[model samples]
Target: MPNETLAGLTILVVEDVTSIRSLVVKLLERLGCEAVCEAADGETAWHHLKRRKFDAVLLDFELQSDDGVSIAWRIRGDDGLINKAVPIVLLTAHDEARIVEAASKAGVDDYLVKPVMPDRLGLRIRAAIDKRQDKLDRQARSTEVSWKA
Candidate 1:
């Protein structure tokens, strides 16, 4: 059965390896995502990011042309992106502490080590989205308070 929270979300899956990318896409579909976009590299992923708004991003830590941290940084920093504050779940084979720290610093909302299990993937994605939403909510509240002050 599909998860209710993820049922209607549009997601972007970025991975260099064909098989892994396919697996991730299938998993997202199984979770009932409304739309699943694919990108084999950071460039393509950036193109998708700029052109479309995704509920969440599943980004590979190591890509042939670019790294997930850099892409995450770009997403967080780029004002031109349709979804600059979109939730990002970094998928990586590396479980190193330094890498995790870097990803956190880059503004990734969650991190998952490969091979990703369906249950865990769903949890991570949902968590990331919730985290982003919480931040947005807090920011909005702050802005409103300041405006009324």
Candidate 2:
């Protein structure tokens, strides 16, 4: 919709709850993602991350077996991941300060509360991607400057 801001972008959605995962997939499709992959748990999500490159990742904060912050940690810390620098958005029902702080330290780009609205979801996704891109651009520029010196 609206020229499809996320058109042709591949994304990963990791959520344990079947209903919530389905809802997120539907929303991503509506947002015009070319390919949206789903993972029910951290293991499945890790499998996808290792094998495929995603433009962004949307993770549920609480899963049946693992938490989203831990997943974010692996994504950021592990050099083996195909998309280690990819933007991550954490979704959660809890609004606790500690949860947000942990996610932030784990390199999560954005956080959203449960029962996400379409507009807010779109905004958050865009913001996360933009923020990550900005960081990458800065890193590239720093490397260029260092080489020039």
Tens-digit lDDT track for model 1 on 8-31? Answer: 999999999999999999988988
Model 2 spans with C-alpha error above 4 angstroms: 1-3, 146-149
TM-score of each: 0.94, 0.93
| The 10-residue segment with the lowest total lDDT in model 2 | 140-149
lDDT of each: 0.93, 0.92
Estimate candidate 2's RMSD in Å.
1.8
- Tens digits of per-residue lDDT, candidate 2, 1-149, equal 34376778899999999999999888888888899999999999999999999999999999999999999999999987678999999999998999999999999999999998877888899999999999999989888843454
* Native-referenced Cα lDDT, model 1: 0.93
RMSD of 1: 1.8
